[model samples]
Target chain A: MQRPYNFSAGPAAMPVEVLQQAAAEMLDWHGSGMSVMEMSHRGKEFMSIIETAEADLRELLAVPPNFRILFMQGGGLGENAIVPLNLSRGGVVDFVVTGSWSQKSFKEARKFCDPHLAASNEADCHTRLPAPGSWQLSPDAQYVHLCSNETIHGVELHELPDLKALGSNAPLVIDFSSHVASRTVDWRRVGLAFGGAQKNLGPAGVTLVVVREDLLGHALSICPSAFDYKTVADNGSMYNTPPTYGIYMAGLTFQWLKRQSEGNLRGIAAMEHRNMAKAELLYGFIDQSSFYVNKVATDCRSRMNVPFFLRDESRNEAFLAGAKAAGLLQLKGHKSVGGMRASLYNAMPLEGVQALVAYMRDFEQKLA
Target chain B: MQRPYNFSAGPAAMPVEVLQQAAAEMLDWHGSGMSVMEMSHRGKEFMSIIETAEADLRELLAVPPNFRILFMQGGGLGENAIVPLNLSRGGVVDFVVTGSWSQKSFKEARKFCDPHLAASNEADCHTRLPAPGSWQLSPDAQYVHLCSNETIHGVELHELPDLKALGSNAPLVIDFSSHVASRTVDWRRVGLAFGGAQKNLGPAGVTLVVVREDLLGHALSICPSAFDYKTVADNGSMYNTPPTYGIYMAGLTFQWLKRQSEGNLRGIAAMEHRNMAKAELLYGFIDQSSFYVNKVATDCRSRMNVPFFLRDESRNEAFLAGAKAAGLLQLKGHKSVGGMRASLYNAMPLEGVQALVAYMRDFEQKLA
Candidate 1:
């Protein structure tokens, strides 16, 4: 059966191959009598599954030796409070409000620590990234937080800000949920990075946290033992049953990613090149057309999520209906952002973009 | 292919029918052209999935209308702290420590509230339940906490203690992770009941929280918004990106549970009847045998988790190997309690228990 190209912002599209593999192994994973979901997390079968998943993710992302990859529950929002509870120590923390996600992070941080806004793109209605040099560096900040990519507003940070260069001695933390494996990460500049797996990764339920080793033991006395980074890391993400099925699915995704090759690039590097190409195709078509508008600044536009608006606001429902008829799905934008959004994650093929652009153009011409 | 009988405590076994259905729907669920994993939580497809799951569970458990069912992340361990943060209000809370799970719950709750030990079976090494009349219920306690089924030590509170009858004004909170859906719950006696889906429900990541409407608000100021019961209840468990896939899988399990029947009984009642029969068959066999012994008192023994030891400790390896050879897997006991454990959750059939008993009897004869 021909599956429609799903453009959901999250719980978004996944590689068809990943789904097929998971389906095939859903009953018995690799000759084990039990399904991945039914296996004990501490059992050797599942231990190998989690270990391989963590190792493959580390390799794919080029995660450093100094970092511990802890598989946790609670998505990015949960981490907003958990991060401060672990690292902030009720001290001053700097936040750059890029869009909805980072804005939330700043607010949740207020519960356990003193959060200071360093910069905000809300001044420009989140159409552009706030300049790193313009940020107000907190000299005594425990850590600086920012959303690397805004799924709703379609904003991306092409380059990470250097805290040391910005005259801040604090470690840098980024909520990279929307665009994690789509690009390479520079580990030297980041103290902690967290993302929900529902978007670019395999599935929801399992959260990925890559934190520097030095950041482990600073969790507050009130931190839940399950959410405490030190306990999770010390127990190898098995302090509790570590979302066994989610990890297994993610492991299969990592394997699929490893086999991906584009020219000389492989794995995440390959995904990065393909994602950029897909983004360029959609954005170029929109830029050349008078019927569509993408308001985000060109230099900072997200490569994963491309939010566009039809010139005629009256035609929004028709566009969605037509898009669905053409086998393109989940194109409606977030309620907060009134427009159409097409998330071109790692799994969104270049052909999917071509199909979406074709559908949009045909709809525009038909109305014209 | 014939599958083995798995006996892992939590994340133990599931109905074969559920696994088969999940595998079939992993690619395209109900012709939605997207896996349940790929559907947005707010989208109609997933909304229907969660809503149906919730409704079915409500029917199966006969949950009262005044209670709210929350689909959350972070397992039961996470809830140990979350329950206190939401209910304790930083005041005195009563805990009845029965075994490993309740012990952990007690320790984690200490971080947020003044935990008063109302009752304990630790002196008996968790071999029996503490009598309700003997409990030291605090007059000013905000809530009384206990584990309905202790997975590790093979102890269970068959009948929920009546806090009102005990002259405690506090509400009763029960952690029912290991035996949820296997038996009927007395909602009149329970203020809140929480469990992870890994054992009797579905997968590991999603947690089931049934909280009374009156207990909705009053989270500690330090509580993470994602973990706040009121916030989660208000958002329909979508204040953050919930464990979408886990919920979907659990929804399938609920449907599977609803179809279950035994003689004149149906659903949870049917499960209760079948579980009692299964437990009796295994326990009766153990009682008749000279080579095996179950430590927990018969009145307080868990129907789900039956922990037993061989007459000779030196034959533990031989027994496990022989059981494995006979298609009985993961029968080795928890490291904390050194003996074999057979967890007969709802998914475990009469045949599986019969197979386990047969293996034990044969192993005993061979050694003798």
Candidate 2:
């Protein structure tokens, strides 16, 4: 079967190996005479699947014991409400809008709390993160919120802000939707991080919420039990019936991540290395070509999602068609910002980036 | 591979054929060169998947043009809060609680509005639905709610009540989680019908909401945009990135249902016939046996979930083990209501029921 390199910014590509393994096990998961989808979430069979997935994820991210990992639904947008409901304490909340995602989060939080804009890059058309030092954090803020990566605008925070260093005692909350699992997270600086799994993990429904334990019990009285962090943690994320099939696929993907090897390093260390290589390959090609340009500032550009536009703006359709012919898919950018975006997540191999670069170079030559 | 028949209420069993097909398509769906999980929700490929799934569901349920179909996250419990937030309009709401789910809905709705329990079976341990004539629905009730099938108590409303006939023009909302696609729905009487796909359709994470056009714009000011039906409906359920993989699987299951035939009867008609036969075979065996008892009222017993108690409660372990050995699995009832529960949803075939019956008889004979 002719398979293409997919670079869509989420519900994005997953490891092909993970999919193959899942397919092989779909009829009977590990010889249990039931598909993982068919097994009870409470049954030992499914419990094992969940446990391993969580454990592998913990190891990959080096998650601290004081934090809880929750598999949730409703993606990052859902969490815009859920985060404030759980953390805002119905008081003041601080937000730093780096791009489209945090802007959305800030707007959503206004419904639940007294949201104060700590910083914003809206004037710059969301092409870069506002420097952490410039954020005007609220002294009474329940938590300080920011987007670590904006999938739509291709802006990323290479290093998370230290809220304590910035004279804010409020826990730092980051919407890390686009780049989770692609690189290491510094839990010391993070009180909570959430992302939709569609980007770097598995699917749309299974969202990952990693929050510090101390921040768990403060959900608003208006919060639904299913969306309440304390209830979900206490129930082992089964306060409501979870997205079981998505969890299963994610578990397989986790196992695949653990088994990945690159020379002396393995697992996420290898993943980080590979992601760096893929990002460099694509970004290098873009920088070298006069026919293409990426708009993000150099210091904070996302390594996962790279948005570029053709120099000849009218040739966008032709570029996309040529890329499609070369077995490259989903080159379309966010509609709000008309361009091409190549999202090279943890699942995108260096080889896939090589193929993408090769296609870009060929297309540029034809256009010239 | 050893595979056990799963019978959990929701997040329940999936058809083996569907699982096999999903597995086969997992790596590269229809040679698109990406798993369904990997496709961008907004791309042409995934839009096709979403549209096809929606169309298949619309066809299977014969949902009218005036009704909007929303694919959402959150299970029935989340909907408990979301329903009131969207439909309560700060007015009084009425509930007819025959079982656990509706009771939970009522309690949650109390947080948002003045929810009056119009009718209840708590006095009777929820064995039957309260008669419509006995319901004291509020004159100013914004909406009247009911659980069409209570998964835990195994009680079902075989025919829905007409609220207008009961002197209330309030819309009727039904939670059809356990038996959504197992039988036909009378859309004429239902202003909204919400269900989690885990029971009879596909997996958890995908909740189906069919709401009439009139109920579209009544969301409370504080309702989260993600949970607002009007926002969801207006965006064609793309207000947020939908549970893409779950919808795809549910769509495939819908297609499977469409192709189903038992001597020329197809789709919901065939499912109804099969469901009746399966329910009868198990219930008939329980009725005749001295070692088994089902306490639900005959008129209101759920065809999908059969809760039965072994005459000798001490032999429950032996019964489950013996049943497992005989390839009949997950017959254990819910912990809240102890005993064995055989959830014969749309996916459970007549052969599975026959095997369960034969196993029951064998176990009972051994006891004798």
Candidate 3:
């Protein structure tokens, strides 16, 4: 028997092994006689859980020695304010409005800093990413904000832009919420990276923040102590009681990711290989079929979230119903962009994408 | 078999039934072929879970229609700063510092408002609550902050202070993290009530905020859109991607709490009755035993957390080791104030209290 593939962009699908382990240990974790949720954050049991989770994540991402990984509570939306509050210094900051997530970050940063438009792909209807060389980098910008993958727009920056090469001395802050761990990150090009854990990492409550140690301690006075990177780092994200159960779930996910293997690849490298194949399979089918059309540019199409529209929109309801019957779930796209989307996160197997493509193909043939 | 009676306090013990149900539904929830963690917050399945949870909570608490219930992230510590950011209006806010939690809230509020220490029990080592008559009511205060139950010091406000009788119009804001849903609330006297869901609720990530409708739209400009009470209320706590799993776990716990019964009482009334019995059982044992002592004044002792000390501190290790061996776990006191502490949350059955009493009796006999 197979479980239906869930395609939620976030609070997204999780690996079956992770879910199995979580279910198996739901009552007691490692013979501790208490569930992960029941353990105090300050207790040795929970401390080990969080510490191991951090170490595993750091290893999984090959996080630099200078970087500190924090397990925080608020999602990517909360980090919009937190990032500016910590890094912006109430000074000029550059924003590349690539899509909805970055656009929201740019807008939210306005309250705390002077967010200057570095570049925008809005003119292209966010179907493409602005060329890195075209950004009007701010001379005195505290940081440059970008969403590495725009979940809604189905656009992703395959490679991070090097700020120093672009004549900006500022740090590059990326919100990689939808696509974190799907591919390797180039630390040299990134000063800080944050993501909500729902999509690729684990669950929704936990937000992962990996920042260069040098970027710490410059938080604005108004920044809440719990949200202050320095405070969180200082206390190891236990400044406030952390999301214990969520961290435990993420730890299980990290372990599962660690066990993943591909031909000549392991861990994140394997995930990247698998994700690339899944994306190619889905996007390849969509590009070839006359019934389907993906609006995003070829180079910028997100490997995680692939949004597409049916040529005949009237058949959308019947298509979705048939897909459900075929065990393909949550094919409905975001309301902001009314169509269909299939998120191929780290937990999404190639077989799931194959099934989706098959379902789409069947639906299209039935129409003929 | 009875599991170890865990008493670490917040992120404390959950109802076994909730854990069992969560485990059963880990792979697929109600035949949706998706775990609660995997469901999109906007999806019908998750929406139903959250809605039903809210409805049940309102019925259990008898919350007024005028007060909006918000499922938020960031624990009580985060709310220390958030409460002021939303409600203070940069004006003076009166704080009654009874213990560590309120004291922390008062200091955090300093960044957003002129936080006035209207009262403090630190002089008494937080062993007693300052009378309402003694509180210096700030004439132009925005709100009055207090921790209804001091988890660490084991002091609780048995009855809410009537600010009107005390000659103040400022709405009372209570941090009920350690005691929420364990007992009833008098909403008429409270303008806002916030608590981390780790204790009486379910998990660590979700924070519960119940605020009067009139208090909406007052967030400071610097408030993060996700943290803004108005924005969160408007979007129904989906302003940012909420802690979906935490909320689901809490929903499960809420359902479990709703099924509680004690004699003629049900729900919160049942919990209050059970909690009172558990507290009495432990406190009564401690008070009668010459070897053990609880410092807090009897009239103000916390019904949830009972902090006690042995006359001979040298036997602390032995006492703790014996307790753990006897299936009593996490009875160690907080590092800031050490000795021993037992938290009897709603899930802590009276039998668990009896076992603790039995352990204490046997330990005291060894000394004789």
Which 10 consecutive positions of candidate 3 chain A have the poorest summed lDDT?
A1-10
Which candidate number maximizes DockQ?
3
* Model 3 segments more than 4 A misplaced: none
Which 10 consecutive residues of model 1 chain B have the lowest summed lDDT?
Answer: B1-10
lDDT of 1 by residue, A1-368 (tens): 56899999898889999999888988888888888888888889999998999999999999999999999999999999989999999899999998999999999998899999999999899999989999998889999998999999999999888888889889999999999999999888999999999888889888899999999999989999999999999999999888888888888889999999999999999999999999999999999999999999999999999999998889999899989988999999999998899999998999999999899889988978
lDDT of 3 by residue, A60-124 (tens): 99999999999998899999999999999999999999999999999999999999999999999
Candidate achieving higher lDDT, 2 or 3 = 3
**Interface Cα RMSD for candidate 1?**
0.8
Give TM per candidate: 0.99, 0.98, 0.99
DockQ of each: 0.88, 0.79, 0.89
Q: Output the worst ten-in-a-row residue range by lDDT, candidate 3 chain B.
A: B1-10
Question: For every candidate, what share of the true interface contacts is present?
Answer: 0.85, 0.79, 0.85
Query: Comparing candidate 1 with candidate 3, which one achieves the higher DockQ?
Result: 3
